[model samples]
Target: MIKAKDGDFFISDWLRNVNTLEYLSAWETMNNPDFNYGEYAIIRQSSGTNTFKISVKEWVLKTNSIGITAQAGRYGGTYAHKDIAFNFGMWISPMFQLYIVKEYQRLKTIESDTLNLEWDIKRVLSKVNYHLHTDAILKHIIPKSTLPESKKGIEYAKEADLLNLALFGCTAKEWREANPAHAKNNLNVRDFASIHELNVMSNLQVFNSEMIKKDVSKTARYKILLKSAQEQLEQLKKIDILKAVRKQNSATYIEARNKTGDELEKLTSESILDKNKQALSDFNKKLKQGLNYNPKDEK
Candidate 1:
């Protein structure tokens, strides 16, 4: 939300309280140094509007917006939920309300584009380096002259999670810790990952696979890999994304133990306007050199 004239901008859920009288009184009192303390503004719960005035404290308690510094003063103004703020803006001017919506939507587009660029870089990096990791598996983890245990792919599954753990310092389950809107949210902490972190993670997959068949105990292997991941990721923690695209292509991709031909093909995307797209492609090809899946033939 933005009130350019008032020089206010905040991004969070809008606040609207149908059961309380706080909003109206607060709006009415804006910019008033001697704002009366006995005022309130309660919206009708049924209609979600139709506000009526009441006592201030009751309004505060009912709406749960009472604060240490009750009113927004020199520090711009009292903080309110986006909804309440929008309501205030509307009260201030219909033109202000439209401005708020326009500015908010514009900010969202900028945020979404920035996030997609970051995800694309990570996704592309993951693809290019994938074959290297898989090659490590085929050359080291696979049994020699024998088929390994085939009861279930759990061991292989664990290795895949290990790759994830190495790269991101957590399993997919851990990735979802906040359980953010799995798809609804377009940007997240993961979206902020650095290119260096993604690179280290790709190499770690190969390193983990190589260790799996080297008789290194899982505990020892995990510790080594985790330590490497931690130390490397430490560098990325400081990445500056004042530098950091486009549509998400409306499809989600899953991390893999192994990629199918179709999956690889699906991963390829049309180039954005970036001049470096070809370089990124060549770089990707080198990364996945030894992988079994052929991205070009993927559906």
Candidate 2:
């Protein structure tokens, strides 16, 4: 994806650094083995003098920076975690790095608000829908005579997988394969699933639970569930994306002000991440539901 190569910081020589070119290349290399390495290596080692191998082991030796790395083989390339990437970004261009940090911080500011709003909304909606999925599960998963709390817990886990499969288009293991962008190779779509998808997932799990009892095969259920998820996403595409983003942004600002209808400044007084940032993700979801979302369908 990196058609251009530029170094902002030198892992060894302070003169070289990382930038957008590095981030994109690293992402491509990790996801696409056939990624144009001949093109990328030049970029990876483009530092005029600090051509140290991008190996994690090598980097530690060179700069004592414990993070940032270069991997090799069909599934390897240079990668830095967010912290290291921030360092690399600064190393590449001080102002550019600052901008990167600022923009990223902005995104996170927005995203964290989004995440918290999502968490709260889930807490609210789930309280009511918890039994919808669980009741069906209890009947299907338990023995007729007696049911234990432990057994109900087991049933929930299975139902959760079914939910993962429906909206995520993958089970837990499958999501990692599809999204190797993980810091730990364990990325679940739930980690970043659209509020709409998560909402639909709750409904799907119940639907899937019922389907399971009807003796539908897993493959059939998977196909049906995926179709349902896609259809739901498609239905929401009727709205304008930019408009939705702005509307949601406004709602987020207000919620942060209201602090989810609680004491605003005091409740989140210690958020070191974003000073005076607000919570509006639930508003985003509230507005976007049946109107817009799920990037897979956005395009």
List per-prediction Cα lDDT, in the order shown: 0.49, 0.48
lDDT of 2 by residue, 208-287 (tens): 86786886654566667777877886775664433323212111001001112122112222211121112233323433
TM-score: model 2 vs. ground truth? 0.37
Q: In candidate 1, residue 265 scores what lDDT?
A: 22
**What's each prediction's TM-score?**
0.44, 0.37
Question: Which predicted model would earn the best TM-score?
Answer: 1
Instruction: Kindly give the stretch of ten consecutive residues in candidate 1 with the minimal lDDT sum.
Output: 266-275
TM-score computed on alpha carbons, candidate 1: 0.44
Q: Which regions in candidate 2 have their CA more than 4 angstroms from the true location?
A: 1-119, 122-128, 144-155, 176-187, 213-215, 240-299
Which digits, one per residue and each the tens of the lDDT, describe model 1 over residues 1-299? 35455644332112334422345445535634444453332233322444523333344555443331234447643455555556756754679769988999999998988887777778886676566655555555554413323311123334555655445544444444444466235343335455776677676876776775676655566667877877876875676544543233322233322333343222211111111445444433543473343323211
As a whole number from 0 to 100, the lDDT of residue 253 in candidate 1 is 30
Worst 10 residues of 2 by lDDT: 250-259
